[model samples]
Target: MAEQLRLVVPLHGEQVSNMQQLVSVMLVDDEIMALNNLKNLIDWEEAGYTIVASETNPRNALESFHKYRPQIVLVDIMMPVMNGLELSREIFALNIPVRILILTSYKDFLYAKEAVEIGISNYLVKHEINEESLILELGKLKYEIQNTETNDRYLRQRLIRHLIGGLLPPENLEIGIKNKYLDFKIGSLAFLFAKIDTSYPILKEISVVAKSHSNFIWDIFNLANDTEYMDAIRLNPDEAVFVIYFKEEELKETVREIASKTCKKMQERFQQDYEHTISIVPIIVDNKNQNIRNIYSIAENSFNYSVYMGKNIIIDYESIPTAVNSSFKEVSVILNELESDFVKRDSESLKNRLNIIFTLLGKPPWNPEDVQNTCDRLVFTLVKFRNKNSIQDNPSKIEISNLFNLNSIRKWFESEFISSVENAVTIDALRYSRIVRKILVILHHEYNVDLSIEEIADRIHLSAVYIRKRFKNEIGITILGYLTKIRMEKAIELLSTGEYKVFEVAELVGYSSSQYFSKVFKKYSGLRPLDYTSGV
Candidate 1:
């Protein structure tokens, strides 16, 4: 059985009845007497309906409808300012799931056909709206409304598909609006594009985790005071976009942080649930392309920065200098160096070579699609090579497919090459080098943890003295010195972000004492943390 969603809000008169759940209803008519009669005409609570709003003025109908968002609306066909059809049109514009009934006299009932044309589904002549007929229609409409809610999931998916494919013109929003599929609106808008990676297919998980993830995203941003409405549109597999309707002032100041935090929370939750992180590249996109191709094009280009900035990270398109996509020939050089570094157990050399490749791709005057396709090809080749060698750690197809950015390729290469070098390291003591390599991996993953050579030696069944000597011989640095270098590098990187204070950065780099971290940082970088920030 499909699970049902129960949404409850306190009604104005909660104690009026013993019913815990009731379908909300609304009545709209030009005559005050008619409105009152409709409200009292049926034993609504007995029929599982509650008249939340009754308005004699059509001008006030829309306001009441919006505020209550009632499931059923009974509106008169002819009225001043706005007739039932006009009011219904606006009410339907919100794309809310509502069953609208047209209330008309015999003369006005001629246009009842028109009400159906305007998306009204039920109609009843004024004299005929008694308890029996009202009961029958409400019961029938209630069933249809519940069925519509049942199918709402697919509708939302269709809405997202339309948004990602590019929304039609405002005039064309009618068909979608008439079906009550989505609230079509235009205003101060900012967009965020997300790149997701998961082993499970999105379709299989659409009902639960996917919806929960989407809900979590909105919950994160809606907490902000300056935003009125926030929504997300899932793009093609592994891609999604968040749309924020912000106050004009917030457009410049808050959008970037909201986008960043959303990216962070999403990656963290997936890592928690799936045991794998979905690296996201989020950027504020240009709304100027609402009708043109550039709307998604600019966002796609910015997301491609995952190539340079790395995974499980956020890069704002506006903050970074634009990069150019590389040509096929230029990318081929990167491939050559990759092979050489793999053969030589040269991780550092590979890092530099990959850095150069990404830097070239990060520059301007390049096609975003071409570069993304190139990265995809590169990741595919690397994964195929890893599988061919029977390496234990091959990236899942989902991960490889999500490698549509530069930083993604860089991270994958560093990791795979580390394993490659480990499998075939040509040092005099093979087991010793492997032990040292294991230590390096720990340092990389747990840079935030307070760690020492003794602790690591115990973790991997080696003596502290042996680990120290072998690490120095194989990697050319004392364990302490290496740890200090890694910590200092992290400190500098965090300080450069300008987001954290010296003490916070110190803690983040595994230093309990800001003073000691600063002392070590100064020795390594030739400057204090604050001083380094000024230069950056």
Candidate 2:
């Protein structure tokens, strides 16, 4: 014999009545008088129906749907705003397993059959319902639905717990988990959090691409390449977390490689404009362990560690050693060398110093923070140099105030680093170098023209003196000297090709006087421009 399910009664009592425990129901009718009459005449609470919400206004049905999300909807066939049948159809589209009971007074069997086709649970004629009959009908519906108060209550509590768990403050995470009204079993898991350092515009592009398909969850999981238990969830608008379950014996280095590759792929695929950090916490917890109060704290600390150590790093809780001092020492050494080069105004030495730092770090060629800091310091130094020295005292000179504001170096560094971090290993250093390279290219390209150093600086959004110093530090030549060399070279090329007269060539290279152009060209090349070009 099969086990019979227990039922509860509906009555004015503290405990649920016998018939009430078996089912939950909702009631809806367009006629206010009729709806209230039914509510007063029938003891619905006794019939195992939980009237979550009763609305005389059908317009509020959608709001009720969001609020209650009930298992059953008793609706009138005709109503205003949202008609009963139309509302029923729309509600069914939500894919909720709702048992809808339709009430109608007209003798329309055809309409009743249509309701059945539309998945209505039952059709009742309004005139046929009396106080006793209603009780009997509701009791039958209760038994049919087989609602369980205990199970329903537990599920609701679990959903609430899940949502609250993710949103809790860092300090309150574990406390929130512990105070959950529902019971859940947790297992040992590995957690990682990440922040994509991108501008709002770039982030929006990523967002659009991320939602282009339903396979995002699966795609990210596959990207992790973890065959073991894997779960991923978006923690916030700009961050995500991946939870992985693996035995301690698993190769941990492989996890770091996977994470780095994933970050690279995201950058390449989305053309991301900034560096991002993937913080890792590889931990082991039993299935029954539910404490997560300090989860965010641990994760946040790990995140800051990653940022401090530089981005794109994977730090495992299981692998940290006692020799943290050695790591700090190496970083300090690099910083000291960079600071020394900046103070000395040694352009070639600074470049060589940065190269050494990159080699020591064993990161990619594109990585090194030295060059970035050097660019910043060089810019500032030039601005100070110009403020103290008058350029008119030496016409063959450049002025810092004419070009860029050295004080805005921080903002400039941020924009450059955040815009092309993907192609860089040492993101900060690469950004500074790249910007310096761009300025040099522009200067060289327009060397023979009547170019204003300040204009070029303004074009690239840097100060003239700062640009000159930074260019000298990176390219091993002062900006004016380089430009002079380029114009002299062009003058020689024109003379050699016999493209124009000596006077014309002189004017072409930005000198109004041919004698002056010849004097400058000979001084730079150790020969007269015409003689160097003639070679006879």
In terms of lDDT, the best-performing candidate is 1
What residue runs in model 2 are displaced by over 4 Å at the alpha carbon?
A: 1-183, 189-192, 197-234, 242-284, 287-293, 304-317, 320-323, 326-340, 356-536
- Decoy 2 TM-score against native: 0.28
lDDT against the true structure, per candidate, is 0.63, 0.52
Model 1 RMSD in angstroms: 17.4
TM-score of each: 0.42, 0.28
lDDT score at residue 178, model 1, on the 0-100 scale? 30
| Per-residue lDDT of model 2, residues 1-536, tens digit only | 01111111111113433432434456677678987876777666555565767777776876676455566777888887877788888888865446787888876888888888888877778888787776766666555554533343334334433543664333434454444322332223445554543221111223322222233333443343222234455555555555544333334554444444444454343333222222344443334345543565555545433322443445564443222323323534554444333323334554565455434433322222333344544344333333322211222123221212222332343332222222222332444587676665565445556778798889989888898888888768877787787677556655765546788888767788888888887798889866766785
* Deviation (Å) of 58 in candidate 2: 48
Q: Report the C-alpha lDDT of model 1 over 1-536, residue by residue, as the tens digit.
A: 01111211122223423333577889888898888788777778877988878898887878777666688998998898888888889998876668899888875545866877878987788887778988999899888876755454345445655655776434544475434434333324555566553322112323322333444333322322112134555565456665544433344445555556656655665556545445554445434334423556766666555545555666556665553534656665565546445433467887787778767666655445545555565555455546644556644333444443556656665666666655544332454556776887677656678887889999999899988888889778888887787677657656765667899989877889999988888888889889998894
State, as a TM-score between 0 and 1, how close model 1 is to the true structure: 0.42
